[model samples]
Target: MHQGGKFIVVEGGDGSGKSTQARRLADRLRDAGHETVLTREPGGTASGAALRQVLLEGSLDARAEALLMAADRAQHVTEVIGPALARGAWVVSDRFVPSSLVDQGVGRALGVDAVEALSDFATAGISPDLVLVLDISDDVSKVRRASEDPDRFERESEEFHARVREAYRSLAAQRGWVVVDGNLEVDVVADKIWSVACERLEP
Candidate 1:
């Protein structure tokens, strides 16, 4: 392990299993003699959770929603993530700025550059050491998402998801993220995520 805490981010479209993989990765890190903190975007703290509900409110405009997410991220980073990292504890986030870059930036036509700038401000200089992008087909994502209540983003059309996926791929290529196929079984997907996390965490 390194001197500072490792920040690992997992991102994907709805039903891509990001939450599941994040939890598993946290467990793996804990078992490997390291302290770990598991968190999620839009709801990592009390204020963030409150903002999350507003962000999910059906009446908010797309741009408004994006701004709310930014606000939540800023609070979460300052109150939760930064403190955890300062303690040299590994932080595994189920979703991070990448989600906004895809869903709000590309899918909502907000422009990726604008999204990136907002993310930078919201994150307050913290950057993930490694980002695991779980890529799955829209069909698969939709089928899996069907089991849950359709959020505003999930209710978007298939074309929207395609654009979001493309944005994720492009972002990964530009940012040196590790792209993983999310169509595999839960354990199989976790193993691949574990491998990449281990590679980055080992000194």
Candidate 2:
């Protein structure tokens, strides 16, 4: 078992398979005898869920949307993630600060530095110990997204998603985040993520 709980975040553009991989990783960790808590951004806490509806369903301005995301994150970290970590439970989040950076900062043109600073303040310096970025081509993301009911971000133009993906790639490169090939089959992607996560988990 780890001395302290670890925070793991899965990030990707729409339809890049973040949810699936996050669940699989959490399950794998639990089966290995680690206590794990699986959660998601913008919907983890009661207040955050309400904010998520507004952010995803309402026609808010880009700045408003970004602020709302930060608000949700603050609640999530305080109410759910922070407590879990304090008690020694590994927290696996489907999306975290990186999503705000790419979706609002880059895709909406608010600037990455500004979003990063806001997110840092909102979470009070809490950050993921590992960030797994599911990297997929734009074409693949489009095809995968076609089957789902589009959320506010999913309804964005192809150019917007391209920018989001590029920003994720750039951030991952600069931050040394693990980038997984999301175009592969589900089990293949899960195996890859699990392998990488195992390396990061403390014994």
Candidate 3:
């Protein structure tokens, strides 16, 4: 059974409910007597926090963006994820390698193979055991983020977002990750996520 030291990554485009679902699933795992560390990419470590602000708020070249994201991931895995997993704790991250693969790789017109290679190098081959992709439409993403102040990536052109969303779908399918419809009701979505986790991670 997939128990100790397991790393589960929840991935999606903006407004796809990945963060909420990741937190809920991690909590459920903890409640079920698992030592779970709920975390997120680009902000998990202290160095990563500063990198997250620059990555999210400031504009940079596509290559720079990819490199910065990789830097954050490096620090995050080294400081937080690696230690937590080494001590027999399960780590559930809100986003991980897939986000870069879609955002910088597809959305920013960078090649997926290159971004993936960079990410793999950054993480030193440490990869997720499970990746749950919460999928939603572009319209839904816009509506859900309407009231919030848009970040650099969030303020990209609609076409960019379209590509990102499509890339997420394609990549998730290619990687055999679970694709959950994020248009469902919150409770329902949570139930579906939890059910899948139970099936896959439980003995």
Candidate 4:
């Protein structure tokens, strides 16, 4: 049987540098001879992009937000992620199910178990082979976001961000996720993530 491609997920808060690291990992993997597809949640597909706008810009109840995220995820996996993996292209995503678990589950106080169940159904059982969580302090996160136009989640109160960070830490510990210090310089953080990805996914 032909071996399918690996699925890797990079997760973190708004300013935790997940996008940068995800791109770096994908680039490194491709340079090393592996076909790589670098994508992001809430907007990986056309339909997903529409849903992302509603979820981020429109004000909705927590339940509604969670459901929208699940909806986007379903399309993302079906349309983009699954096909790439089937073709033996490594899929490196900026955010995956973990975002729903933290944002809606813990941050929104919607319950992690329920959110996880929804996420499982959304992705149709597709899960990341390796999850790299860029961990950063609340202070660092705030500093990083200060210069940018805050998004819906970024504009959330400090308590909410704190909850999200703690939830990430808890999930990382329980799930054996590879956590990197996002507080470091971009290149340094990327190097650490690259080292782990090479060892686990490429080696």
lDDT of each: 0.88, 0.91, 0.88, 0.91
Give the runs in model 1 whose Cα sits over 4 Å from its true position.
Answer: 1-3
Q: After superposition, how far is residue 20 of candidate 4 from its true place, in Å?
A: 1.0
What is the C-alpha local distance difference test score of candidate 2?
A: 0.91
Off by over 4 Å in 2: 1-3
Specify the poorest-scoring 10-residue window by lDDT in model 1.
Answer: 194-203
Candidate 1, 1-203: lDDT as tens digits? 23578889999988899999999999999999888999999899999888877777557877898899899999989988888888999999989998998988898899888988999999878988888999998889889889888777788788988899888999899989899999999999999898887677671
- lDDT for 27 (candidate 2): 93
Of candidate 2, the 10-residue stretch with the lowest lDDT total is 194-203
Per-candidate alpha-carbon RMSD to the true structure? 1.5, 1.5, 1.4, 1.5
State which candidate, 2 or 3, has the greater TM-score. 2
Tens-digit lDDT string for candidate 2 (75-184): 99999998898888899999999999999889989999999999998998788889999999999999989999999889999999999999999999999899999999
TM-score of 2: 0.97
Better of 1 and 3 by TM-score: 3
Report the candidate with higher lDDT, 1 versus 2. Answer: 2
Error of 2 at 142 (Å): 0.6
Q: Write the per-residue lDDT of candidate 3 for residues 51-98, one digit (tens) a residue.
A: 999999986999999999999999888988888888888999999999
